[model samples]
Target: MEIYQLVFETAIEINPGAVAVGAALGIVVGVPLGAAIAKLVQKRAERGVKGTARVGRLRAKRAWDA
Candidate 1:
C-alpha cells in the first residue's frame, strides 16, 4: 500500500471519534456561557429602558413647568 493510502485510511478511522468528542465538548462548554451572556444582556437592556423613561419624565416635567 502507498503511504498516502495508509494516511487516508488512518484519517477515516479517526474521523468519527474526533467529531463526536468535539461535539460533546462544544455542548458542555457552550450552554452555560450562552445562558450567562443572555442574562447579562437582558439586565442591561432593562436598565437602559428605565433610564430612558426617567429622562423622558424629567423632560416632560420641565416642559410642563415652562
Candidate 2:
C-alpha cells in the first residue's frame, strides 16, 4: 500500500496542473504502472503461497529469491 501510494503521490507532485491535461496524463501513466505492480505482486504471492503458508516460514525466501 505504501509503495502504491508513493507512485500516485509522486505523479501528482510532478503533474499538478490544470484539470484536463493533468488528469489525462495521470491516467495514461498511472493505470499501466498500477496494473504492472499488481501483476508482479500477484505473481509473487502465487509463487510463494505454498512455501510461506506456515507462520514459521514468515521470513523465508519468496518468489523474489526462490
Candidate 3:
C-alpha cells in the first residue's frame, strides 16, 4: 500500500467517540493549566511593579533631602 493509503486507513480505524473523548480530556486538562500560568504571570508582574514603586519612592526621598 502507498503511504497516503496507509495514513488514511489508520485514521479510519480510530473510532470517532474515542477521538471526542480525547479532545474533551485535553480541554479539561488545558483550561486549569492555562489559568494557573496566567495567574502566575500576573503575580510576577504585580511584584515587579511593587518593587519599582519602592525604588522610586526611595529615590524621591533622597532627592528631596539633598
Candidate 4:
C-alpha cells in the first residue's frame, strides 16, 4: 500500500469546518423549501380531487336526465 500526497500552495484549500457549516446551512435552507413544495403538491392534489368530483356530478346529472 502506498500513500501519495500533493502539496500545492496555489491549490484551493478545503477546510472540514467550512464543509460542516455548509452542510448545516443547506439543511437550514432546505427545510422551508421542502415545506413550500409540499404545500404546492397538496394544493395540486386538492384541485385534482375537486375536478374529479365535478366530473362525477356532471355524469350523474346526465344519467338522471337520460
Candidate 5:
C-alpha cells in the first residue's frame, strides 16, 4: 500500500538511525490504531444488525395484533 511505503520512505529521508526507529514506531502505532478502527467498525455493524432485527420484531408484533 502507498501508506505503508510512505512510512519507510519518510524514515529513509530522515537519517539512517531513524529508519529503523521509525519503522518500529510505525508498526507499534499502526497495530493499535488498526485494531481500534476494526473494533469501531465491528460495533457499528452489530448495532445495525440489532436495530434491523428490532424493527422486524416490531413489525411482526403489529401484524400479529391486527
Candidate 6:
C-alpha cells in the first residue's frame, strides 16, 4: 500500500479520540501562529518603508541646501 493509505489506516486504528483532539489543537495553534507570522512581516515592512522615507528626506534636504 502507498504511504498515505497506510498512514490513514494507522491513524484511524489508533485512538480516534486522540486524533480528533490533536486535530482540534492543531487548528487552534495554527490560526494564531499564522496570524503572528503575518503581523511580524507587516511590521517589518512598515519599519523598512519608514526608514527609507527618512533617508530620502534627508538626502533631499542636503541636495537643496547645496
TM-score of each: 0.48, 0.43, 0.48, 0.50, 0.52, 0.52
Model 6: pairs clashing at backbone N, Cα or C within 3 Å: none
Give per-residue CA lDDT, model 5, range 12-44, as digits (tens): 877868788867898999999999999987998
Model 3 Cα lDDT, one tens digit per residue, 1-66: 699777655665777677667668989999999999999879978777657678789999999999
| Top-lDDT structure, candidate number | 6
After aligning candidate 2 to the native by TM-score, how far in Å is the CA of 18 from where it should be?
2.4
Window of ten residues with lowest summed lDDT in model 5: 46-55
**lDDT rank order:** 6, 5, 1, 3, 2, 4
Error of 3 at 31 (Å): 1.2
Residue 43 lDDT (model 4) = 92
The positional error of residue 10 in candidate 3, measured at the CA in angstroms, is 6.4
Q: Which residue segments of model 6 deviate by more than 4 Å?
A: 1-9, 49-66
Q: Ten consecutive residues with minimal summed lDDT in candidate 3?
A: 7-16
lDDT of 2 by residue, 8-47 (tens): 6886777666545767888999999999999987997888
Q: Report the CA-based lDDT of candidate 1 relative to the real structure.
A: 0.82
Model 4: CA > 4 A from native? 1-13, 49-66
Q: In candidate 4, which residue pairs clash?
A: none
Off by over 4 Å in 1: 1-14, 49-66
The 0-to-1 C-alpha lDDT of every candidate, in the order given, reads 0.82, 0.75, 0.81, 0.72, 0.85, 0.86
Q: 1-66, model 1: which lDDT tens digit per residue?
A: 699778756766889687668668989999998999999879978777657678789999999999
